[model samples]
Target: MYTKPPIRKIIHVDMDAFYASVEQLDNPNLKGKPIAVGGDGKRGVISAASYEARTFGVKSAMAGNLAVKLCPELVFVKPRFERYHEISKQIRAIFHDYTDLVEPLSLDEAYLDVTENKKGNPSASLIAKEIRARILNEIGLTASAGISINKFIAKIASDYNKPNGQKTVNPEEVISFLETLDIRKFYGVGKVTTEKMYQKGIFTGLDLKQKSLEYLDTHFGKSGRYFYYIVRGIHNSPVTPNRQRKSLAAERTFSENLSSEIFMLQKLDHIAEEVSNRLKKSKISGKTITLKIKYSDFTLHTRSKTLTYFINDKALILDTAKDLLYQESLNNSVRLLGISLSNLNTEAKKNTAGLSLNKKVSVQLKFDF
Candidate 1:
């Protein structure tokens, strides 16, 4: 069998518990302690939980109730969208300094294809190190990185070394790595699917690779072809610059000074949903979603959240906006409600393109966030 040419140099960078980390970095008192970012409400979900909290079983998207139950001493703070957006901007600047091919998955993670990087450095490992150092020295935040040939491999590698760690998957090791990797660890695989796969005796990439393409097609449908290809370390996804913005939306001007927190939240949610629907229509997902709010006294604030994954769904974008708004204890009246989704999907970002063409694609959301 002929091995493919030397693999490309791809890097996936993810910031750990982004919102919680930024909060900790801003205030020294919060460092080294378990912290969670989100509202302490009945409906509030944990937006981000620090690594320390995670050790105690806390996780993002868990209910605020469950998170506190997991770690009784977990400190909860409201998200500061403006502050998070500032840090996100600083981090993206660092990425751009390295290469323009940076495709941000969200504010906390991005994929960088450095096969022919501008730094003229052939080794992607060095670049990842330099980038991490800069983020540490400047932003005072830690990031984990995965370096490999393609998005699938790099994503897996990045998670291998977590919490200020880095992992590099060399081309030669791809086969062995996939062979032993747990099927549950696959990028798009989730709990339900993993259990189902286990029932089928497909525990790892080796098992997946050994299956017939037709079998995978008849069973998992189109995703089967993708799994088969990725197991062999074949992925043609490209790094896309988040240049083309799909839509822009701003909130209407309010005549009255509103002091009700619920009212402001309701308004913001409405604006967010409208913008989100537009994104879905364009067949695009965005990393950045900006929320604009104007206080009664004309104090305007815009809070933007960049994500680790591309957000194409309306519910997620609106939820993020709602989370950001919940943090602002709106004692003052608001005048504006605006939200916009930017950094639409790049060429490689459009995973749905081929899936759209594939008649066998499943309608269910099989993967976990």
Candidate 2:
């Protein structure tokens, strides 16, 4: 008799409208009102929108002016990143109580492998519920969770019940669940891919499953294989505990577009200083410096130079950014300037010991939850 493979238990925890929710929590007066976290000026971009504002078609990344037009009552507040970070740390501490295998996607979301948790819970669904409860009780914020065999499915399930809810896709239901899922709901299928899939008559997982591997590969290139596997609930990515940072950056959008190089130099100097300060705070340096320019017309450009040795000094970053700035003439009036450092020292560190780096892990045994 052959032994069955063990099914992994994964949970994805996502905070609901994290930034906006935090703003509402801290200031009771902002509760139940339309608010956006960002500047309200012409160049301001909405970083996060409260659910109340979302009802009025306000959303993250929307222009502040457009957001205001959409909802006249929309309140724009500057982002309090330090406060967000502090709250994020508290939430992560709650995660550590249940599992060491936590993979954070951002300050607001994370993937937790509860197959072997510190809490010794056999049911991933129960663990997710407990975790969400802890976050609400201790940190005073609502969160949503999805429990499944892999990250992709768990991530999708997390959205099924929005704003303080949880869903569990058991091992037996994975196949049927994937078959009925909307193609747009599939992880990694963005607006561009969704349109292409629709054109190819692949609006649902069942339609995608009917296409041969060669056919999908021909149409989607390398992503075709990814689509094929994930549609069948075959994503094997593990929840890495020590996900390293690959880059650090700082940028500023100007209220008024700058036309002269002299005006741009002053802006670049400030951006470089911000980048350098961030690098030092993280205790990391990089060999590559990149300059990003966004024109008033909304076209973006970037130029980079890699040095033999890493540097994190403000003056060095400014000097390098200045060289890249003058390398080419201004394409249009500059509306935003940013500096980023990559090829980070953090990337050179060794992987955490005892963690499997394999892209695929065998799953033969049907898990209980």
- Tell me, by TM-score, which candidate is best: 2
Write one digit per residue (lDDT tens) for candidate 2, span 1-369: 223224689999999999999999999999999999995745788899998999999999888888988999988888999999999999999999988999999999999988988988899999999999999998899999999999999999999999899999988888889899999999899999999999999989999989977899899998998887777777767898988899999888889989999999999889888899989998999999999999988899999999999999999999999999999998899888999999998895554223232344233436688
What are the per-residue Cα lDDT tens digits for candidate 1 across 84-203?
A: 888988998998887889988778999987888788888888899999999999989999999987888899988987889999877767778888998989999999889889999999
335, model 2: CA deviation in Å?
1.6
Clashes (backbone N, CA, C under 3 Å), per candidate, total 7, 6
Clashing pairs in 1: 106-307, 106-308, 107-306, 107-307, 146-158, 251-337, 258-333
Report the error of model 1 at residue 117, Å: 1.6
So what's the TM-score on candidate 1?
0.70
Clashing pairs in 2: 4-364, 4-365, 5-364, 5-365, 6-364, 6-365
Give the poorly placed runs of model 1, Cα more than 4 Å off.
1-6, 243-369
Local error of candidate 1 at residue 21 (angstroms): 0.6
